[model samples]
Target: MQTSVIISTYNSPLWLQKVLWGYFAQDRHDFELVIADDGSSDETREMLAAMAPNSPVPIAHVWQPDEGFQKCRILNKAIAVAQGERILLTDGDCVPRRDFVEVHTRLAQPDRFLTGGYFKLPPNVSKALTQDDIAGQQAFNAFWLMRHGLPFTSKLLKVVATSPFDEWLNRLSPARPTWNGHSASCLRSQAIQINGFNEDMQYGGLDVEFGLRLRHVGIEPRHIRYSAIALHLHHGHGYVTQGMKERSHGVKENTRHNRLTWAERGLSQWLDSSNRATLLRDDRLTRF
Candidate 1:
């Protein structure tokens, strides 16, 4: 089945370049990539334009005007135009391993959503990563990462394991499987059924909130944390505040308490908005 990989990006073109390279190096190439841009400058547009021509798969850019943190809004827009049966959500700052796409595709089930995890890199290592490293698939190597400054830890096993070992690690992992923005996938129908993300959220636990809604609707969350890996590039979280976290906490609590499946301010609301047509007809999305 065709998959649309939706990557949310802001103003980090340099990190985005690496993320795109990671996709380019994927073992599977049957997927299209949709970039859900939350109002970045012209630089990001130009970068995508320059890189799109050589991409192995189709690429589309869905951008919204910058009005603080409206990730859910832009993501909803991206989901509206995505022409795939399944959608994989991630961030531009996370570089996937070569087998990432294949793993997600193979593990996908009709009644479940897949959630993966990322191995974070420090600022120095994040900056040190090159396109060659990602394309060659060495960036995911534990020794290569250690050589480039990642400290040794048992977590590195997530980077080195193959086959049965990875599967065992995934089962043993304590981290709960949720709709992680860094690495997650679900059916397009499933996402649309509950109306996409909650626009009421602003960065803190928003992904978890979406997952809670999916769970409410009887979609099981499956763990692919060890098998589908991504390397998270370091960046500042200036947008995150205690207030945002508190507000998101409340929204999640409301979801659990009320068993709310539909989002009040999500995809359906965006589609019914007055400007939906204009946004869909814009030149930002590329057919190639």
Candidate 2:
């Protein structure tokens, strides 16, 4: 089945470029990349223009006007336009391993959404990484990360283990299989059926809330945290606020308590409204 990788990004063009390079080197190239841009400047568009031509897979830019952290809105817009049977969710600041897409594809199953984890890097290592590092897959190696400033930790096993060992670790992991935006995958139709992400949410538990809704509808979650890994690039969470996080948390609690299956302010709301987002299709960079 065709897959679409929906990545959310604000302005971080430099990090976004690194993330794209990781995808360009993916072992599997059947998926499309959709940039769910949340009101970034022309700099981001320019960067996408420069990178789109040489991309191994098709690239689509679904952008809305920047009006604060409307990640949920932009993501819903991207999902509406995505042309894939399955959708993999991620961020612009996270670089994937070469096997990232392959692992997600191999693990996808009906009525189940896959949730993975990311190994976060410090600011120095994040900035120090080059396209070559990601393309060569050294950026994902625990030894390489440690040599470059990441302190050794038992968690390094996430990237160090392979095959049967990784599978065993994944099954043994206690981390809940939630809809993490950093690394997650589900059927596009299932996402649409749940009405996509809640547009009222900011950051915080928004992803988890979406996962709760999916569960309410009988869709199960599966852990792939050890197998499908992403190297999360360091970036400031200046957009986060105590109030917003608390509000997002409250919404999540409501979803869980009420067994909500559809987002009140999600995809369908955007589609029914007059507001529309711009789409960059093919190599033309033309608005659609």
Candidate 3:
């Protein structure tokens, strides 16, 4: 099935460029790239315009006005426009491995969503990475990362290890495999059934809320943290605030108590004819 890789981004054009380069190097070429921009400056739009023409796969930009940390809103907008049956959601700062898309495609199930993990890089390593490193696939190498000042840790082994041991560990880990926005995939129809993410949420725990809603609707989360890996670029969480946390917590609590299967303010709001006409008139929404 065709996949739509939805990447969320703000103002980090440099990191986004590196992430796109990683997508350009994907071993699987059947997926399309969709940027669910959370109101970035002109720099990001210009960068996308310049790169869209030469991209290996189709590129689309779905953006909204800069309202502080409205990721859920923009993501719903992207989902409204995505054309693929399977939707892979990630961040623009997370660089996927060559086999990332291939693994997700191979493991996709009708009654489930895939939850993956990321090997977080230090700020130094993230700053040092270049498009050439991503294109050559050296950015995913454990030795290469170590040489670039990554501290030696067991988690770093994810970069190079693809053994059955790793798979076993993924399955055995106590951490509940929730749908991480940094690296996750689900059927587009399934996402639609849940009516997309809760727009009431902010930065913290928004992904967890979406995952919980999916489960409320009977879509199991399959753990693929070992196989479908991505490298998360280091960045400050300046957008996260106590107010945002409280709001997100409130939403999660409501979902837990109510067992909410659908978001009240979600993709359907944006998919309506009025919003579509407005988006069509807006120069910001570009499809390639």
lDDT of 2 by residue, 1-288 (tens): 389899999999999999999999999889899998898888998998888888988888878777889899889888877778899999999999999999999989988999999988899999989989999988888888989999999989888889989899989998888889999999988987898999889988989999999999999999988899898999888988999999999999999999999998888864544324333332112222
Steric clash pairs (candidate 2): none
Per-residue lDDT for 237 in model 3? 89
What root-mean-square deviation over C-alphas does model 1 reach?
2.3
lDDT per residue, candidate 1, 19-47, as tens digits? 99999999989999999999899999999
TM-score of predicted structure 2: 0.94
**Which stretches of candidate 1 lie above 4 Å from their native place?**
272-284
Ordered by lDDT, highest first, the candidates read: 1, 3, 2
The total of clashing pairs for model 2 equals 0
* Ten contiguous residues minimizing lDDT sum, candidate 3: 274-283
TM-scores, one per candidate = 0.95, 0.94, 0.95
Kindly give the stretch of ten consecutive residues in candidate 1 with the minimal lDDT sum: 274-283
lDDT (10s digit) by residue, model 3, range 1-288: 399999999999999999998999999889899999988999998998898887889999988888688899888888888889899999999999889999999989999899989999999999999988988989988889999999898897577767686688678767798999988999988888898999988877889999999999899898888888799999998878898898789998899799999888877776765334234344267887
Q: lDDT value for candidate 2?
A: 0.87
The clash count of every prediction, one per candidate, is: 0, 0, 0
